[model samples]
Target: MSDAYVALEGGSVVAARCRAPGTSHGELVFTTAYTGYEESLTDPSYEEQVLTFSYPLIGNYGVRSERFESGRVHPRAVVARELTDDVAEWLTEEGVPAVDRLDTRDLVGEIREGGAMKCGVSAGPDASPEDAKAALAECPGMSDYTDIGAQVSVSAQKTYPGDGDADTEVALVDCGAKESIVKSLVERGATVHVLPYDVSPGEVSDLAPDVLFISNGPGDPANFEAAESLVSEFVGEVPLAGICLGQQIIARALGGSTAKMDFGHRGVNQPVRDLRSEKVVMTTQNHGYTVADPGDLEVTQVNVNDDTPEGLESDDLRVLTRQYHPEANPGPNDTLGFFDDVLDMVDCRTPVAAD
Candidate 1:
């Protein structure tokens, strides 16, 4: 007899043991990463979602705060085949629900076929399948969390100095930004000012940053109107860059459109090919939305598997964006050069001559 139950949107309930006791609801999703459990847990992009580990055994390596993408776990609940004492204890301390010792393969298969869907988890000595179902009944879809940015972004602007003698200035709009993204910019001789998602265009104009970078976040892209406004306000005036949700926002601001993916890309091994260079690289990704139309921006890179626009660029507008995380905290370093390409835009930030 198990003390935990996971209720899916289709009225199916799965029994499991309680690794961390609690009750929660979210969009059920999975990641195929075999490592970086700590980073995945703390990732802000996982906000409002129930994270399932497709890997057979999780927490083989102990949890470490240094590896975290954010200060706390963002997933509403966690599902796994097995959980180590270390991870279970960590999730418990964070007050996040967790359940394991179940058939993760079957759950992953369902998500793959049926797409990400509403889910609820009830885990504790007193938990019941009915409790899980009740949570699911009340759970809202991801698009409904319109103000999800407030749940993960920093309230006030925080600045991080670059390595000694930094030469560039970057104003990063934090729509649930990962710490690694900031660290990556700071390490590259760029003073990074992380602003809240709702920062006004005037405020950013006052800063007059060398570049404006939108960050990865959760929820629907249409909901982030402020970030999209920033992109429209600074398109040709300042170098613009974005990742994951950031990319979607950029495309939306540039007369493009975005749409929700079936299951989304949430792993460390997605392959992307640069259309211009004809070079392919394995990348890390975590977003439920993709740019269905690039608008004014040219599609410079695409996913090898699905041909989704992985990279969008506009030389005339001084803009560059990627649908995957180039900082790659818990994934590959193949795309880390993305930061360099961003800085190059700063060097080329001359005003376009009027026709």
Candidate 2:
């Protein structure tokens, strides 16, 4: 026998001699992103959650440093249908360890039937699967993920490379924003100021930025009333743009509402159709909630797959929001023109005094 795969839960040895890690206690959730494993693992949104990959074979292409969204992997633990013994060459170069393989199908089934619970993975002769499952059953579900934004946010304000000697300044509200978004803004020649997620409108007004940007984040957008109020206060004062959580926050600020999705979109293959241009763009996304009352704002783009609202723009308020990521980190580059569009918006709204 293979030492009778042992399972452990809540630090107790429930299974013994398992092929997988002994036990890892956390709220288990599955992702169907297909690829971009490195990005998914490093996403601050998955904090405290054990991730299970629905795609059976993983780590075949291996991990690369260039693909990492952050400095390190942040998942509580990783579960996969089968962990590859041989990772790609880039992963070896980056020194990322091959994921300890597990029966992902069993893990996903258990999470679905049992309704998402805390669990652990361990490696030892004494580890028991039964004990692991029992301990996980006692753990909680994903209820307080809204707090994740505050936890992962940057501690202090910072700036990144922007279009050198730019005419307009853009204030980027960092709700655990990806570095690539900063890079995109910088490349556009727009001076960028990265602030904490809770930055107030008064602070932004004091900066006198030409544009405001809200970055993507994790968790329920409804919990961020302060951010919504701040954006509302800044409406029409400056050209504003947002992605993912930023989009939802802007919608709420504009008298709209947001709701959680049955299974939140989290991948690179999502298709969004631009209403004005009637162009289809394959984009990346990682959000749990979307605007509920898009009519309150001017809807700009819609998802063809499910008819979900994808983008919104309010000409009266000089603000725009997109539910998908245009940064294209670990995804397609079809929608990168959105960055230029933002620059144009800022140009159109430029204060005559600054110009």
Candidate 3:
């Protein structure tokens, strides 16, 4: 164990006393999520990013391999006010850098006001302002990391047997899919064919799936050109749906545009309103970018706090998307029925059988 410290883009050490002897750098972002540290650490969307946990104490429940969202940890580093024995041990074993024993309140406030910034963390006792400055210089900007999504995406196609009763087959294009997303489909009796981020529309069409599912992932949606092309090719050809990064891609495919938020939403308590019913549902979410304008797509749900687009739909195209996680592994399942909508949409397109 060694002393650790965290530095921001300005070369200022925000916190210190890190015990792990590892160094990391990335965009410094905070998540107000109070639980599910394991799931958050493994979420692919956190790739190339340093995560700050706003919760006072972390790792109270210990680690479990089954709780991981991805096969490996995705965050570059983690900052917290206090780290429990179980958590610190798990992070160390995983080779994930972490820092604690300092005032996270000040650090979080700095991020809240200044927004997420590029940052560096080191577990060496000799960490200083110069070390911080040098690390900052080496840190790449978020937009500059265009290959992040592909880096986290599956290398080849994989298939999961759907547990749902329907004969529906779904072609899932994995940008950086979460394990829960796959489970969500398979448990619902839908066979999911997971493909690479750059898989062509022709390849997916050849699968003869009843629906096209775009998965939530890392990086900017604009950087995923092949996925956008696939979406463009299948807009009217198949029933389409996505979540988080998937939502942004669908927006881009429909001529809409996404923008990086000043401070992105990441937590389980975000309230979103279903425009049709004007009803609010607390949801789980994690993303730095959002669909600012849905273009020709109809807006279905909105964030109650910021009025950002939370969900989109198009009856004519049979396309649907949500910015929050419906699978809700670490949060509420209020929108779990959202999957039912996908099934219903497929059912509508299914030709009735004659007796």
Q: List the residue pairs that clash in candidate 1.
A: none
The candidate that wins on lDDT is 1
Give RMSD (Å) of candidate 3 vs. truth: 2.9
* Model 1 / residue 118 / CA error / Å: 0.2
Q: List runs of model 3 lying over 4 Å from the truth.
A: 350-355
Give the Cα error of residue 172 in candidate 2, in Å. Answer: 1.1
Q: What TM-score fits each model?
A: 0.98, 0.82, 0.95
Q: What lDDT does model 3 reach?
A: 0.85
In terms of lDDT, the poorest run of 10 residues in model 2 is: 1-10
Model 2 lDDT, full chain set: 0.70
Q: What is the C-alpha lDDT of each candidate?
A: 0.93, 0.70, 0.85
For 1-355, candidate 1 gives per-residue lDDT tens digits of: 9999999998899999999999999999999999889988999999999999999899998988899899999999999999999999999999999999889999999999999999999999999999999999999999899899999999999999999796788999999999999999998989999999999887787777898999998999999998998788778888899999999999999999999999999999999999988999999999889999999999999999999999999999988999999998787999999998998888888532232
Model 2, 1-355: lDDT tens per residue?
2322313332332222223333455555677777888787777666666666788876778666787776655555566656564332333333332233446666556655654555654444554456455546655545555566677678678877576777668888877787788888889897888888888766777678888888887667776666777787777778889988899888888888888665566678888988889989898887667788975688889998987889998887788788988888777889888888888887667442321
Q: Candidate order by TM-score, highest to lowest?
A: 1, 3, 2
Predicted structure 1, TM vs. truth: 0.98
Task: Count clashing residue pairs per candidate.
Answer: 0, 34, 5
